[model samples]
Target: MTTMTTRTVEYPADGLTMVGHLAIPAGVGRRPAVLLGPEGPGLNDVQRRRADALAELGYVALAFDINGGRWFSDPEEMMAYIMPLLDDTERMRGIGYAALDVLRAEPRTDPDRIAAIGYGTGGAIALELGRDGVDLRAIGTINAVTTGRPGEAANIRCPVWAGVGSEDPIMPPAQREAFAAEMQAAGVDWRLVVYGGAEHAFHHPNVDHAVRPGVSHHPLHAERAWRDVVGLLAECLPVTE
Candidate 1:
């Protein structure tokens, strides 16, 4: 197994001292990096472990916090905080940019070659960064295909790949259609994968969550999605040894 280094760092954003988990591969040379956004309830071990997995693949990865490093077990409480931010695009942008800055500032990160992958609310933030005109190499999202302000989609320069469960209530057929329309209208190189018989958060493993009904763990699709995202990074942000 390749050696890896992991650490926790704090940076200010959204009027809070946001904490983020950073993972870097053992090689001394700088590498292509990826920013990971956690689900709405907030950052957790799952997201941090994802950073480690990326590190194993020779990519610098940072899983940034959205709620000041707080993880919520209550669905209602999570929405109470997230719904208002949804209305304030600028605030969301501020949060995303702050974390991006941290990732770029890392010595091991190849600032110019970076990608963003997010789940749930984190996915929305990644999309927002794309919409805000960040030069991302690739964008991967799941269960968070929320569209942004009209006309802003044109700013996205990277190829976007989004996946969602067919029966996801949060990201229903209408929402997916709208997201597709926005990507098409913006002339983005985008693709949406609808996993059959899977519900929201299907890529997530079997863990305790407040809202589990609409979400599930589909091992087959989970592995498939991981491979697709890996292929994306290889194509867009190859890490040369």
Candidate 2:
């Protein structure tokens, strides 16, 4: 079984007390660390499971909360709570940096081998961190809507992998194409994977209530996306055997 720990940490941007679930492999000595950012507000069991899975892969993973200890079953309510926070890019960067600090401070975590993975709004934050030159080894995103500000891609120094569903209305084909163009123009080592027949929030298995006509989860695509994420991380930030 993987060793796991939970703690509450204060988000510096809003001074909100947020819960963090940390999982680490047993008998570890400075293992690679990953900051797993949640989809909305704070983390839930799904995010914890992702961290646990990372631990099983021999990496120390921490899923930090952007929202306090609250979650919403209603999609509108969740969007209302999360959307206002996204307007403040500086605050988002602070949250990401604070989470990175928490992960680096862990005994079993290797600060130098750190990377980040985010979902939905969190994915934008992950990209923001990379754009701000956070010195990460790699960054990965799942169904990110925001392609970021102008000239932002040029600032990213690490390898980035972004996965999106072709059917995702939130991130349409034009947006993905533009994002790809920006990454290519910036000369950043980036890869974009458009999964066919998948939609937004595809990795979120519990998000059935928010299923729109063009937005819902597919188990097969989600599995493939998860595997691809793991493979990308392994390639960029492999754990020391």
Candidate 3:
């Protein structure tokens, strides 16, 4: 295993002080980096571990936060906060950009060779960054099948790969179709993977808090989705040893 370094980073975004986790691989020179986004509930050990795993794979990884440093355990509270932000495209873009800037500022990150992979709300932000015309190597989202403003997807400069649960009510087939249509209309390279027998946020493990209906974890699909994202990164942003 590669020796990895980890730390907490704070930055301003969306009128809140966002606290994020940063992980760097052991190597000396700059390396390809990844911007990781967590689920709507907020950043936790799950995402931090993911950053470490990415670092172990030879990439500088930043697990950015969404709700500042607060992690909402109540489903109602999580929705109350996220619903409004979801409607505000600029706000979402700002959050994503702020995290991206922090990641790029890291001495170990190769600014030109970075990718964004987010789950749920974080996934939406990644798409927003792509829509905002950021030059990303690849975009990967889990359970975030969101569409941007009219004609905005044309700004995406890299391949996009999204994974969603087949039974997810929040991102039903229609929403997925619409997202795909938007990507197609913009002529962007994109693909969607539907994990059968899974529910919303299936990539996430069962939490200690109360979750809304239609959300459950499937260990098998979660691992499969992880592999898919890793493959996407390998294809678009290879990490050299």
Candidate 4:
């Protein structure tokens, strides 16, 4: 196995000091890169580990932050910060772009060939960036397929793949239809995967504690989701040696 390097990245966003985790693939020169986002709480070790895993696949990955360095173990605390940001498209774009800049600035990243991915609130932020007209190679989200403002989704120039658990009440059938409609109306190349028998945030392995109803970890589906996202990246943003 090839070795990879990891480091801490601190920056400012949302009037707070943000800490991001960065992973660079070994012996790289202008490799495709990805900007990863976290769930509502904030960036955590899980995201950091995901970034490292992506690096192992020969891509630079930066797990960006939301809400500075704080991870809200309390649902109310998370909602207090995330709920308002959801209503502000530009704020989300600003947050997403900050990490994009960091990723692009990396020496090993190919700026023209990049992707954005996130989970939960992080996924929403990635979608917001696409709506804001960023030229990303691809966009992938797990349980974050929130529809953008009508007509704004046309700005998304890359293929988008979204996955959600079939039983995810937070993003139930109605919401899925709405998201598909938004993508259809915009003429985007989009795909959605509904994992059967899974619940919300199924991609998160450590979400064993059901802080909120209808959210739990599905180990089998989580593995499948990872393979699906990796396939998406391979198809949309193929990195060369």
Q: Where does candidate 3 stray beyond 4 Å?
A: 207-210
lDDT of 3 at 233: 95
Across 1-241, the per-residue lDDT of candidate 3 in tens digits comes to 4499999999999999999999999979999999999988899999999999999988999999999899998898999999999999999999999999999999999999999999999999999999999999999999999998999999999999999999999999999999999999999999999999888988888742256778888999999999999999999999985
Clashes of 1: 0
lDDT of each residue in 183-214, candidate 4, tens digit only:
99999999999999899988887675457888
| Model 2, residue 165: C-alpha shift (Å) | 0.9
* RMSD to truth, every model: 1.5, 2.0, 1.4, 1.2
Best by lDDT: 3
TM-score of 2: 0.92
TM-score per prediction, in order, is: 0.96, 0.92, 0.97, 0.97
Off by over 4 Å in 4: none
* Better model by TM-score: candidate 1 vs candidate 4: 4
Please write out the lDDT profile of model 2 over residues 1-241, one tens digit for every residue.
Answer: 5455544454544577767888877764789989999987468899988998998888889888888667766667887988887777888888888888888888988888988999987788898998888889899999984666788778898998999999888789998988888888888999899999788887888555344556677899899999989998889999787
How does model 4 fare in lDDT?
A: 0.91
lDDT of each: 0.91, 0.83, 0.94, 0.91
Local distance difference test, candidate 3: 0.94
Q: How many clashes does each candidate structure show, in the order listed? A: 0, 1, 0, 0
